[model samples]
Target: MQKLLKLILTSRVYEAAAETPLEEAAGLSRTLDNRVLLKREDLQPIFSFKLRGAYNKIAHLTEEERARGVIAASAGNHAQGVAFSARKLGIRSVIVMPLTTPQIKVGAVEGYGAEVILHGDNYSEAADHCQQMVETTGMTFIHPFDDDLVIAGQGTVADELLRQSAGQMDAVFVPVGGGGLAAGVAGYLKALCPEIRVVGVEPADSDAMARSLAAGRRIRLDSVGIFADGVAVREVGHLTFDLCRRYLDEIIRVDTDELCSAIRSIYQDTRSIVEPAGALGVAGLKKYVRERKVSGRTLVAVNSGANMNFERLRYVAERTLIGEKQEALFAVTIPENPGSLRRFCSDVLGDRNITEFNYRLAGRERAHIFVGISIRNTGERHAFGQLLGEHGFDNIDLTDNELAKTHVRYMVGGRSPEAGHEVLYRFWFPERSGALVRFLGSMGENWNISLFHYRSQGGDYGRVLIGLEIPPKEEDGFREFLDRLGYRFVEESGNPVYRLFL
Candidate 1:
């Protein structure tokens, strides 16, 4: 501990990395009812705190090692950090990245003038290839984390936090991936300011450190989810695991939805969009405060990086409302009659905006509607569900149902039929404004209209499946109505899957 503290005090990171601000997140503080400070490592030179350790590790290399140059295997912020640090120190650098790495990141490392080698399919394979190159090329390998100097450099962030907070903070939340940052920060905080509890946060799907500490021995995960890809490590580093087990107060695991909500919360507070891994600390902190019901105490969450992929923002946005309990999805059943839709809308929907509604008339008695609606806060979904029961409405909350969200919402058309003269037809309509309303207008009270499925696939045309009660007598008029509707239609009533399934 003393040696680590000494190394941190003298780390050479300031030559490249900035002393980022420790600003209070006023929005989070107010909402969580605690003083929440953000360690803005996301504002560092490489837009991540990684360069601190990368530079400090490479800066202290022996003259002989520096002459040999440097090499590393990474596809995220660590790759950029090592490349940037090596360039700053005028050393020849080579970065080995997975072939699956995004072009934006591959370009970022090359922009730093490092030789980028695209190899293998994932980090593990790329890392193995990097080791082979290290043996043949004799380049000094710069680890992203785990080395003592790297740990010491990351420890410097804790040093800054201690100084900025004046030992008044009750706890500090650190993000855990390969456990380097958590290990370093916890070591320093526990040694110098023992009263300030050091907590580590990791994704539930990739919690190597938390599981390791819990078992009193290292445990490697068989596989990990890619949602929080930045911190998706299957195993913790040897040195880092030891340090974390020794110093950390506790480790908290947060789900992907919680991470997304934390990302949104951080944006609301700081106008900064952080990567999923970067939001882990804030998510864990929120969970901690809620579960413990603590308030008014000073808390800190380290915002480790901001290297979010632009394309992933849409997915994050979609999940954020659900995570924050701002949107709730439900499977509801109501009477199947002409005035039922009108009464259901008037009684339940009222003036609230509906996000999505999928209704398929499969039975003569009850109609099932897959619906999404907005709510104000946590626990409101339960209240809303109870309200539905009060109105004699049978409904099942699907807000936290993973299968329902991922696939079931899109599969609302499959069911056994109870209506006679049902003609199943698959329809295609232009995925444009007012197209759906135009199609709906084609149906006239619709002779006990049976099935309807519509989901926009973000394409030129939206696909829909509708089963109408067109008896043999009105087949001619229904065919004329289909022509006026003008959307492409294919009769699927004879299809085997349709015949067997619905």
Candidate 2:
């Protein structure tokens, strides 16, 4: 531990990295009733703290290793880090990335004078291909976050935080992926400032580090959510897991909605849109403060990276209001007589802003309406529901229903009686060309695709909601097929929203 701390203190990352500011987050502090600080690693040369570790590792490579060149596999930020570091060092670098990686990231790596190779569908497959190339060419392979040197370089973040904050921080929140940053920062902080708490933050669906720590060993996940692509690692590094297990005080998991809210919060303060993974520290900090019910203590959140895909902003913006409890969705049944809509609007909705309103006359006597309204908090949703009942309207709160949020809201049409033995499933797959074709082809000739909806979010994975029709006797066979499909899927056939509309 002492040696690791010494290495972090003496790291030569300043040659290619900046001493990013530890600025006060006035907006967050005011809202949370605490002193909130942001470690601006997002302002680094590569727009990510990854440069610190990438440069440190490459700088220490021997002449022989440099002459042979270096290779790495990454879908986003780490690719930029290695490309920038190799350009600065005047050495040949090759970055192998998933075919599904955004063109913006691939172009950025190439702009830094690194050879970019597009291979496979995801990072794991691309990494396998890169390993084969390394064996054949005898080039050095840079592991993203597992190596001691890389971990040491990342630890420098803690050194700067303590110095910049003057060792007065009550807690420091670090984003966890393969566990490099959390391990490095926590190891250094715990050694020097034992009084300061070190907390690791991870996406709820991608909490490999947290789960590993709980199990007392490394545990590999079958799949992970791709919304926070930067930190969507399936397994934590062996060394990093050990370090984090010993140093980190706690690990917190936040969902996609929480991540969206955090991104909005950061944008409000800095006027800079942060990627989902980049805002994870802020999300975890908010969750911690609320859960612990603590106040008046100084807390720091590391703004890890800013390599955001521009197209993802649309999805983030849509979810942010709901995440902050400022939006509510409900299904209301109203009389189909003339002036009924006007009466409901004047008496129930009043002057409240309506974010969405979808309606269809399904019957002669009544109509179903899917409405989204702006509210101050969760309390208002309950109050609004009670108000609707008093106004002689039947209503159901769909605010927390996943099916309603994802599919049924956009699809307000009632179910079709002709569609028999239909099954609904949501599948997550790699977002590469021909991937959908492969999935459809795997279904065989026994079933028909009755409904399908897909929208790209410019991330590594694509989400698809599908409905299939099959005979009742084929139900067991369909289940077996899904299990052998090799994609992450959830059966949504029993979802209430689907039964109500679709």
Candidate 3:
């Protein structure tokens, strides 16, 4: 610990990286009733703190090692970091990325003069191929995290935070992935100022570090959510895991909606659209404060990176309202008479703004409507439900329903009576031209596609809700087809929301 602290204090990262500012987030502070400080690592040369470790590691490489070149596998930020560092050092570099990586990230790595190779479907698969290349050709492999030097370099951010905040912080929140940043920040801060709490934040769907801490050892996830691709690591690194275990005060797991809310909060203060992983610290900070019911203390959130894809903003915008508890979704049943729709809108909804409304007449006497109404808080959702019930309206709150949020909301049409043997499934497929056609083609010609909903969110992958017609006799065949499909999917045919709406 002492050696690593020394290395962090004397890191040579400034040769290519900047001493980013620790700015106060006034908007978040006012909202949370706490002083929120943002470590602006997003302002670094590579728009990510990753360059700190990349440069520090590469600059210390032997001249002979530099000549042989460096290679790495990354889906985004780390790839750009290594590419930028290698270019500044005038060393040959190669970066292997998953085929599912967004083109914007691939282009950024190439723009930094690194040879970009697209391979596999995710970081784990690409990293496996990267190891193969390192064996065949004796190129130096620069791991994204886990190395002592890399951890030490990342720790520099902690040193800066302590110096900038004058050691007055109550807690420091960090995003956890392979655990480089969290391990580094927690180690330095805990060693120097034991009074300050060090919190690690991870996506709930991809919480390798949190799971590892609970189990007292590293645990590998079978699959991880890719929404926050930057921190979507399946396993925590060994060294990083050890450091985090020793130094971190606690770990917080947040969902995608919470991440989106944090991103929106950052934008309100900094006027910058941070990527999902970059906003994780803020998300954790919010969750912690609300859960612990503590406030007025100075807290810091590391704005880790800002390599956002422009096209992804659409999806982020859609989710931000829900994340902020400003949007409520519900399924309401009302009379199909001409005056019923008017009465429901004028009396039940009152003057509330409707964000979305989907309805298709299914019965002669009654009609089901999927509606999104703006609300001030979570409590108001229940109040609105009570108002509907008083007006003889049968309503179901779909605000927290996964099936409704992901599929049924978009697939809101009455269920098809002729749609026999229908099996609904939600799938995630690589986004590119012909990807949808390819997915449809993979399914045989016998089965019919009863219902399909797909909208491109400009992320690395496309989400699809598919309802396929397969008789009981072909259920086994359908399972075989899904096994061969090679895409992550979940069966939603039996979902109550699906049965209710479509």
Ranking by TM-score: 3, 2, 1
Candidate 1, residues 1-502, lDDT tens digits: the string is 8899999999999999999999999999999999999999999988888999999999999999999999999989899999999999999999998766777888999999899998865678899999999999999999888799999989999999988988889999999999889989999999988999999999988998989998998899976656777887889999999999999999999887888899999999999999988998899999899889999899999999999888678768878888777899987788888898888889888887798888876778887788899998768778889988888888887787654564456666747537789988876665446666777776756555677766543223455777788889989988888878766677877754444235
Residue 298's lDDT within candidate 3 is 98
What's the TM-score of each model vs. the native? 0.81, 0.95, 0.97
Kindly indicate the candidate among 2 and 3 with the higher TM-score: 3
lDDT of 3 by residue, 1-502 (tens): 8988988988899999999999999999999999999999999998999999999999999999999999999988899999999999999999999888887888899999999998887677899999999999899999889888889889999999988989999999999999999989999998899999999999999999999999999999988887898998989999999999999999999998889999999999999889999999999999998889888999999999999989888888888888888899998999998999999999988889999999998888988899999999888988999999999999989887767876677667797898998999999888766678877798859799999898878787888988989999999988998899788999987776787688
> What's the CA error at residue 107 for candidate 2, in Å?
0.8
Model 3 residue pairs with clashes: none
Q: Model 2 — which ten-residue stretch has the worst lDDT?
A: 406-415
lDDT of residue 484 for candidate 3? 92
lDDT of 2 by residue, 1-502 (tens): 9888877977879989999999999999999999999999999988999998898899999999999999999988888999999999999999999998888998999999999999988888999999999999998998889998899989999999988988999999999999999989999999988999999999999999999999999999988888999998999999999999999999999988889999999998898877899999999999999889989999999999998989899889988988888899998889889999999999999999999999876777887889999999789999999999999999889988777877777778876767888989998888878888888788868898888888777777888899999799998998888888888898899986676567
- After TM-score superposition, what is the CA distance of residue 386 in candidate 3 from its true location, in Å? 2.7
List ranges where model 2 is wrong by over 4 Å.
334-347, 364-366, 386-394
Considering lDDT, where higher is better, how would the candidates rank from best to worst? 3, 2, 1
Q: In candidate 2, which residue pairs clash?
A: none
RMSD of 3: 1.4
Give the TM-score (vs. native) of candidate 1: 0.81
Residue 186 of model 3, lDDT score: 90
